[model samples]
Target: MAESSGGPKKLLWVMIILVLLSSAGAAAAIYMVLDERDDDNPEAPSEEVVESKPPVFLTIEPFTVNLADDRHGTRLLYAGITLRVEDEATRELLETHMPQVRSRLLTVLSGQEAGQLTSSEGKQQLAAAINERLSEPFDENQPPPELREVLFTEFIVQ
Candidate 1:
């Protein structure tokens, strides 16, 4: 009876030792796999930081013009325009020759038909026309001012 009890105790101790060794081995394998993954994928190079410049805007006073009587009778357009210029120098150039700028704008605006002013395409066309006209040099000797875009703040047709 004593021998039988001692044999059972020895078997239990061996089983416990086997379980502990297996658990340690599994933990070591998992750690090695994670470490290998970290080594395989080195940290990505940091992205380059770019310096961006702010846009410069020049606002023109609102314009009221008589639309062409092509399809309607004596229609009018009241539009507020803001000009995006490439630099301060172009804005200064426009400020210096405001009378000529207004004249050119009025000529283009007065020619637009009431029917044409109602659609988005017409508005885009109008902006393009304004851009083209404004891009022309104010003086024969000077180069044209760099006009980036023409934005309409308000548009009303009656």
Candidate 2:
């Protein structure tokens, strides 16, 4: 009876020690993993401390010009223009040269008659010419201006 009781006591002590050892090992493993991760990014940025910038909003003024005389006579044409610039500096450059852009547009449009201005081919030609003229003022190394499309807001012949 004594031997049987001793055997059970020994087994119970062994199980307790094993349980404690396993728990300690698991804790050590978790600590090691966390420490390694912290070393990889020692100075992680805090969410609240990080700053974010707002998106920029850009817009261009619309253009209006008179077309050259045709069978229908002189015509007034209005166009809404939008330009995609690389950055604020490029935008400033464009604003500074707006008068030149306007004059070039007027010259190009004035050469066309009412019939030519109304046709699809003529509008495409005008768009291409405007893009070309705009690129002339910017630095040669800089990317060309992005002209998405040209729209005729008003067209009237008198």
Candidate 3:
């Protein structure tokens, strides 16, 4: 009789544990379903609006550089550069480093041959070279800015 009673007590404890576990599992399933439903609803709080930065341009003063002259006589190239920059910060940085920038540009412009500076194709090539020069790392701490274009506002070869 005592053994039979102990068996009934053990069976009752196991049944209670199983019932508790089943209840917890059901509750978890319901919570997951509710979470998925919340995601499906369009009335949920949305993501924040990201502000966009506008395009900025920086213009450098005209460069009057003497080309590599030959028997054709002394030649000059007057080029005014306008940089289409990625941001205002870059333009500000360029403004701060104007002297160094000017020196680099002058070197580039003066290196061209008179014949090379005379044609439209030559001017385009010069612009591309300027673009590359403008984007070079000027400061050791900060990275170079993205340069969209190097436009020759004034191009005269004489």
Candidate 4:
């Protein structure tokens, strides 16, 4: 009776030892895989992080324009445009040609419709067109402006 009781206790201890060993092995394997992945990755976080220049933001005065319409009444669009630029030099360049930029924006905005500006796709297309027009050379010999993005801080149609 004593020997039989001891047999079960020994078996239980062996099972507990096996479970502990398996868990330890699994943990070690996971650690090794993660370590290997980090070593293999080129953009590892272990390297030093270099500080980058913040994007330059320039806000233009809001625009209120009558959208093209065929109905009995007029449709109006009000938008505040914010431009993202690369550097101080680019911003300075834009400042010098602000009049031309505003003129071009007005031309583009006047061509849009209330229904067109209401949709997201239409808004994006308008943004793209404005970016293109703004980035174009003011003169035949002048270089294109370095305008990164055009964001509408305020956009409304009525």
List runs of model 1 lying over 4 Å from the truth.
1-47
TM-score, candidate 2, is 0.49
Task: Report lDDT (CA) for all predictions.
Answer: 0.93, 0.67, 0.88, 0.90
Off by over 4 Å in 2: 1-58, 138-158
Model 1 agreement with the true structure over 14-69: per-residue lDDT tens digits: 99999999999999999999989977875855478888878989899999999988
Please write out the lDDT profile of model 3 over residues 26-87, one tens digit for every residue: 99999999999999999998898888867688989998999887678889888888999988
Q: List, residue by residue over 1-158, the lDDT tens digit for candidate 4.
A: 34565887899999999999999999999999999998899886665788988889888999999888846368999999999987888788788889988999999999988887889999999999999999898879988888899999999998
Instruction: Tell me the tens digit of each residue's lDDT in model 2 across 29-135.
Output: 99999989987994876557666544332355565667777767667776665655555665677677677667776777667666765677877787677667766
lDDT for model 3, please: 0.88
Estimated TM-score for each candidate: 0.69, 0.49, 0.64, 0.79
lDDT of 3 at 70: 68
Comparison by lDDT, 3 against 4, better one: 4
Best by lDDT: 1
- Model 2, residue 80: what's the lDDT? 63
Sort the candidates on TM-score, descending order.
4, 1, 3, 2
Worst ten-residue run, lDDT, model 1? Answer: 38-47
